[model samples]
Target chain A: MNDKKTTHFGFQEVPVEEKAERVAEVFHSVAAKYDVMNDLMSGGIHRLWKRFTIEASGVRAGHKVLDIAGGTGDLSYQFAKLVGSNGQVVLADINASMLGVGRDRLTDRGIAGNINFAQCDAQFLPFPDNTFDCITIAFGLRNVTDKDMALRSMLRVLKPGGRLLVLEFSKPQSEILSKIYDTYSFKVLPFMGKLVTNDAESYRYLAESIRMHPDQQTLKEMMDTAGFVRTEFHNMTGGIVALHKGIKP
Target chain B: MALFMTSTLTIAALASAEKMLNAALRYDPATRIGLAQLEGKILAVQITAPALQFFIMPMDDELRLMGNWDGDVDTRITGSLLALAQLSQTEIHNLKDSGVTVMGDLSLLADLQRLVKNLDIDWEEMLSQFTGDIVGHQTAQMIRAKFGWAKDRAQSAQRLTSEFLTEELKALPSKPELEDFYRQVDDLRLAVDRAAARVETIINRKNIKEKSNP
Candidate 1:
C-alpha cells in the first residue's frame, strides 16, 4: 500500500531524495560553530567519548583508516597521530563547508604528511574495495539519508578483519534518566544553541534527530544485517550516546 | 526547594571546574610535557569516602580522560578524599605511610611524586596572552619574589616544628637514639651470622666423617 520512499528528517517525513539536501543545509549553517557548540552542549564530554572510541578502535601504527562524515576532524586528528607516519587517515565528509573547516583546523594543528581529506558521501564512499583497515563514523551516521547503504559502503572499503565503529546519539536506557535528558535536550539545548550559534532551529533539529535515531539494539541488528560480524554497542552517559562496533569477515 | 537549588548549583559549579581544569592541564606547557611519561599508560585514581574514580591518559602534552575506564590500569592509586587533598597540598609525605594504598607499578607513584614536586606554572606565559610581555614579566617577577619569601618562611617554620617535636618535646626518636637503634640491630645481625657459621662448620665435619666411613 505504501510504495513511496520516505525518510524522517527530525520527526518530519520527506522524500529520501530530498533528505540529503536538507541535512546539508543544516550542517552548512552550523559548520563554523560546530566544535564550540559541541563543547558547550556536552560540556566537553565529547572529548571523552572520542577518546573511548579511539581506545576501542584498536588502531595502531601503519594502518589505513577512513573516517566517514568526519566533521571538524577531531577523531581524524587523533587518528593521524595514532596511525603515525607509515599510516594514512582520510577524513571524508559530505558537506564541503564542514570538510573545509576540518581541513583548515587540522592543517593549523600541523596534522599533515599522513592525513588526507575527502568530500564524499557515506552512502557511496569513493575508495577502492578493501581499502581501509578501520572505518569510523562519529556522530555523523545519524545524518545520513540511508544508513544501510552507508554501512555497506563502509563494509565494502574495509579489509577482512577490519573494524567499523559507529558512534552516535541513542535512546536512553532509563525512564527517569530519559525524562531528565528530554528536558535538557529540548528546553536547555536549543536555548544554548541560540545563544552560541544564533540558530535555535538547528539545535532543535539536533535534539529531534537524536531521538529519531535507532536505539542500541536496533542499530546492532542493522549492523549485523549489513554483513558485519560480531556487532556490539557501548552505551555511554546513560545511553545518551552509544558507540557500536562491527567487524568485517 | 532550597535543597534542590543547592544541588543544581553544586553540579553546575563542579561541571565548570572540570572543564576549566581540563583546559588548564591541556594548555600548561610544563604539566603537559611532564605528563608525557604517562604515555600509553592508564592511571586510575580511586578516591574513597566520596567514592570517585578518574581514569587518566597522558599523551603528548595532553591529559586525556578515558571515560569510565573499567579495564585494567597500569597503576591504581586509592586513598581517602582527605588524604588525596593532603597529598595535593604536600601536607602528607610518603603516601604509603599516610594510609594511602597503592596497587600496581611503584614507578608510577614515584613519577607522580616527582611531577608534583617539579610542578612549576609559568604565570607570565599565561599573562602574556592578555597584558603583553613586559608587564606580564614584571608582575610575574614581583609575584615570584613574594612566593619565594613565603616559601622560605614556611620551610623554616616546618624545620622549627620538626626540631621541637623530635628534640624539645621528645615526640619522636632523636637522631642519636635512631643511630643507636641501627647500631644494635647491626651487632645482633653479626652475632647471628657467627652462630650460623659455627653450626655450618659442625655439619661439614660430620659429613666428612660419614663420607670416610662409607
Candidate 2:
C-alpha cells in the first residue's frame, strides 16, 4: 500500500484508509431512514431508476446474480422473483446497518430460499472468479474509495459474456437543469434531511460526493479500462441519474 | 401413499376438465376469439386447499391440459376450486374483488381473463353435430322458449316491484315533487345571494361617506 495514498470522503480529502470508516459513519447514521429519504428526495423516481436497471439487466431464471452495495435490497427482491427457485441472488453491502435492514426487508416480503447476504467491501468481493452471470451496484459506487479497483474486481468476478449494471447519480445533461438540480440538491435535500432524519451534514456529504463522482463518459471509459467491453450508459430523468452497462469479454 | 393418490387424482381431474373445455371450445367460435390471444402460452392453474397443479396450453386454435410442470411457469392463476368455477362464467372485471387472485405478466393475465369471460358455448350448434337437424332444431327452440320465458318473467317481476314502490307504496318521490323541491332550493339560494348583495351595498355606501368626511 502507498504510504501517502489519499481519497475523497465527499468533498473532503482523507487518507485512503480513513475514507471507508467515514463512509461507514455516513451510512450508519442514515441507515434507518435511507429508504424513506430516497423516496422523499427523488420523489419516488428512484424506483423507476432501479426498475430500468432490472429491465436492462436481462436476468433470467436459474441465473446467478450479485447485487453489490445493495442497500435495502430493492433490486435483489425483484431479481429474486425473476431468477425464481433455481437461481441465487447475493445482496452484498459493506455497512452492517444497511445489510441488516436489507435482510429484514427481504425476509418480511417472504423473498427467501434464493437470496444470500454478505457484508463485504466492493473492492474485495468474497466469491469465486467468473461466478456471477450478472452484477449490479445501484447508487452505491460513488461512495467507494477506489472506484477503479471496485470496477476491476467486478470484472474479475463476472463470467464471460456476463453483464455489469451500475445505476448512479450523474451530471445532468443540460446546464439549466443542472443548475436547478444543484440548487435542489444543496438546498432542499439538506433541509429535508434535517427535517426527516435530523442529519443535514450527512446529506450535504451525499450531494458533494455525487458531484465529486465521475461523469457518464468518464465512467464508461473507466469501465473500459477495467476490461469491460462495449460499455454504454442510459441517462434517466434529464441525466440526474444514469444506468451504465458493460459486458465482460 | 396419500400424496401419490392425491397427485393421481389431480391429474385425472385436470384431464377430464381439459377434455370438456376443449370440446366446448371446438363448437363455440366466440370463445375461440379470446383463447386465440393466449396461443403458445402455458397458464398454470394452482387450486388451493388441496393444492393441485394443472396447466392450460393454448396451441393452434385449441386449449389443452398439459399436466403438472415443476419447471419455470410463465403465468400462474391461484385460487380455490370454487373461485375457478366463478371465473368460468363471470367476467374478470366482475370478479376483481371476489376472492380470486391472479399473478403473471399483465397482458397474458388480461388475455386469459378475457378468454374465460367470452367462453359463451352454443349448445344448439354443438348438439346439431351429433343429432339430426330436425331434433336439434326442435330441442334448441324448446330451450330458447324456456330461457325467453324466464327472462320475460324476471323483467315483469322487476317492473311490478318498481311500479309497486312508485305508485302504490310511494317509497320514492314523483317527478313533480322532485322538481318542486329543486325549485325551492334554487329560490332559497337566490334569496341569500340578494340579501348578501344588499348588505355589501350598504357597507360600501357607509365606507364612501366615512372616507369623504375624513
Candidate 3:
C-alpha cells in the first residue's frame, strides 16, 4: 500500500495526490472571474497591499526576479518595468488556468520581452538550483498541501545569500480589528462571493484556507527551520497580511 | 536526433496544454469554443480598474465574510454573499434557522455602497449574469479583475533567502555612483525587523525579536 496517508479537502480528508488537481480545478473554475472576485472581496485594498510588497521587495533595475504563482502577472508586469531590458522576471504558476490569464494580461499591458511564464509546482520547481536572485510567493503558499516541504524546496533553490519574501493572510492583532474583520470576512466576504462569482463554495474554501494557513510568527519560524537566517515579518494592515522576509545564510 | 527528440517533446507538451484547456472549460458547454481557445494563451488582464477596496478599508479585516461576533471571520461569507443579498426575508429567516445570520448594521452596508459608487462600478451590468453564491455577477467580475492581479502576484513571490547578495539577484551597476542594492538587503531586513520589534515592545506584546542566527 502507498505509505502516504490521506489529508483533508475542506473538512473531509482526501488522498494527497488529488489535492494539486483539485486546487488546479478551483483556480480554473474562477480563473476568468478571479480578478473581479478579488476586488469585491477585499474591497480594493489588495492593490495597495501588493504595492507595499513590491516596494518592500527592493527589486531594482537589472535585477532578475521571479514571481511564483503569479496568477495574472500584476507583480511581474511591474517587476519587468523596474528590471528594464537588462533584467528578467518570470511569471510562474502551477495552475495553467492562472498562468494563461497572467501571460495574456502581461502581454496586453505592453510588457516587453523581459517577462516570461513558467507552469511549475512550488515544491518541485523546474529550474537550476541557485538560479534566481530573489524569490517571492504572495498569498499562494497557503494553497499548497505541504507548506513545510514547499519552504524547504525554496531554501534549496536559493543561493546562499538570496532572500525570500512570503506574503500571505495572517491573524489580526487587536481585538477590535479582529472583531470587525470577523464580521466582514465571515459575513461580508462570502456574501460578496455569492453575489459575484456565483460559486460560494470556492470563496468559503478560500476563507477556510486562509484561517488554516500559518500565522506570521509561525511562518517566520518555518522560514528559520527551512534554513532561512534572520527571519522577520512586517505585519501590514494590522497583521491582516504579513510579509515574512528571510535570507539563506 | 537528440535535438529532434527534444523539439518533438516540446510539441507534444504544447499539444497536451491545448488539450487541458479544452477539458477545463468543457463544463460550460454553452461557452463559445473561441472563448475556450482564447483561454489557452491566458494573457494578463487589462482591466482599467479604479482603487482597490482593501486600501479603502481600514484593515484587511474588511475581507472577512462569515464568522461570529468574536471577530474571527466565519467561512460562509466566501461563496454566499450575493446569494444572501438576493434572499427574501423568508429565505433569510430559513437560512437563519440553519445558523447563518448575514445581516449587519446599516453603516457597513452604506460603506459598501459608497465604495461601489466611488469606483464607478457598473453593478447592474456586471451582476446580471452573476448566479450562485459567489456574489452578484458584477461583484464577481470586479473581484476577479481587482484581486486577480494582486492575489496571483502575491502568492508566487519567492526570494533568494541565501544568495540575494550574489549576482543572480544583483543588478549590474557598471558606472560609478550607482548603488549595489543586494548588499544592502541584509541591512534593510534588519532595519525592518528592528522596527517591527520596536512596535511589539512598545505595545507590550511578547518578545518577538529577530531570530538570531543559531
Q: Which one is best on lDDT?
A: 2
**Per-residue accuracy of model 3 over B143-211 as CA lDDT, tens digit each:** 556556655565555334323434455554332324556557778999999999998787663333333
DockQ value of candidate 3: 0.01
- Real contacts recovered, all predictions: 0.03, 0.00, 0.00
Error of 1 at A16 (Å): 2.6
Residue-wise C-alpha lDDT for candidate 1, range B115-198, written one tens digit per residue: 544445565664343335786576567656756786899999999998999989999998899999999999999999999999
Residue-level lDDT for A3 in candidate 1: 86
Which 10-residue window of candidate 3 chain B scores lowest in summed lDDT? B51-60
For residues A166-211, what per-residue lDDT tens digits would candidate 2 score against the true structure?
9999999999999999999999999999998999999999999999
| TM-score of predicted structure 3 | 0.53
Model 2 scores a C-alpha lDDT of 0.80
The per-model DockQ list reads 0.04, 0.01, 0.01
What tens digits encode model 2's per-residue C-alpha lDDT throughout B12-130?
44454555668767777766866766665667777683355566766546675644333456778888654564564444564476566777764676676677544555545533432
**Model 1: CA > 4 A from native:** A1-4, A39-48, A51-64, A82-87, A128-134, A159-162, A174-204, B1-38, B42-55, B68-105, B120-214
